[model samples]
Target: MRPLIAIPARFSARTSALRYAAEVNARSLIEAVWRAGGEPVGIHPADTGTAARLARFDGVLLPGGGDLAPPATAPPTPTTPSTTSTPSRTPSTSTSPGTPWSRACPCSRSAAASRP
Candidate 1:
């Protein structure tokens, strides 16, 4: 079966409140996939039938994006709060593990292909 890839694109109006939106351009990714011998399909998040369509593809990829609310494994407060002083405490921020977003495409390169 010829490999098919689906790339997710989320474009917003220029004045939106996004601090650092994802920079994974769909056209570029699709081009790369084609050059690598896979059939790439670009998809948008608002596409209602994405799931049904992706079901026909080989694999699903979650591309790079801004951080979401931290995972629910944070540590609990160690000390009890006193009535007099404004409860002294510090909240922590979580960062992603810096995993490179895998480009979703098919594994189509053959063993005999010349290495560039």
Candidate 2:
């Protein structure tokens, strides 16, 4: 069967927080999908029903953007830090499980860490 794909907008009327992405948006990705020989569908913000729609599509692609202001929680506690602590400079092996290029969830990390 022909591949069916859906891309949701990064922001909409319902969006409460400011956007952070400086690069391409969902629309461009949709165009890329068309160029790649797949069907692309755009999703609306208020349409919570898209969940059902997404299920119908062969795949769902959530494009990149700002960090969603998920509910705040207590910060991680720092303990026993001398000089060995260091952030991994290596990129994630894969972000998504099923897609060709595994896409890491946008909310998973801050923009600084993931940028190329």
Per-residue lDDT of 15 in model 2: 33
Please provide the root mean square deviation of candidate 2 (C-alpha atoms, Å).
10.8
Per-residue alpha-carbon lDDT of candidate 1 for residues 1-116, written as tens digits (9 for 90 to 100): 45776666666554246665553455555556666666766566664655566666654333445652222222333543233322112212212222122222343233114234
Whole-model alpha-carbon lDDT for candidate 2: 0.46
Best by TM-score: 1
On lDDT, the leading prediction is 2
Task: Mark the regions of model 2 whose C-alpha exceeds 4 Å error after superposition.
Answer: 10-26, 47-50, 68-116
What is the overall TM-score of model 2 with all chains considered together?
A: 0.41
lDDT of each: 0.45, 0.46
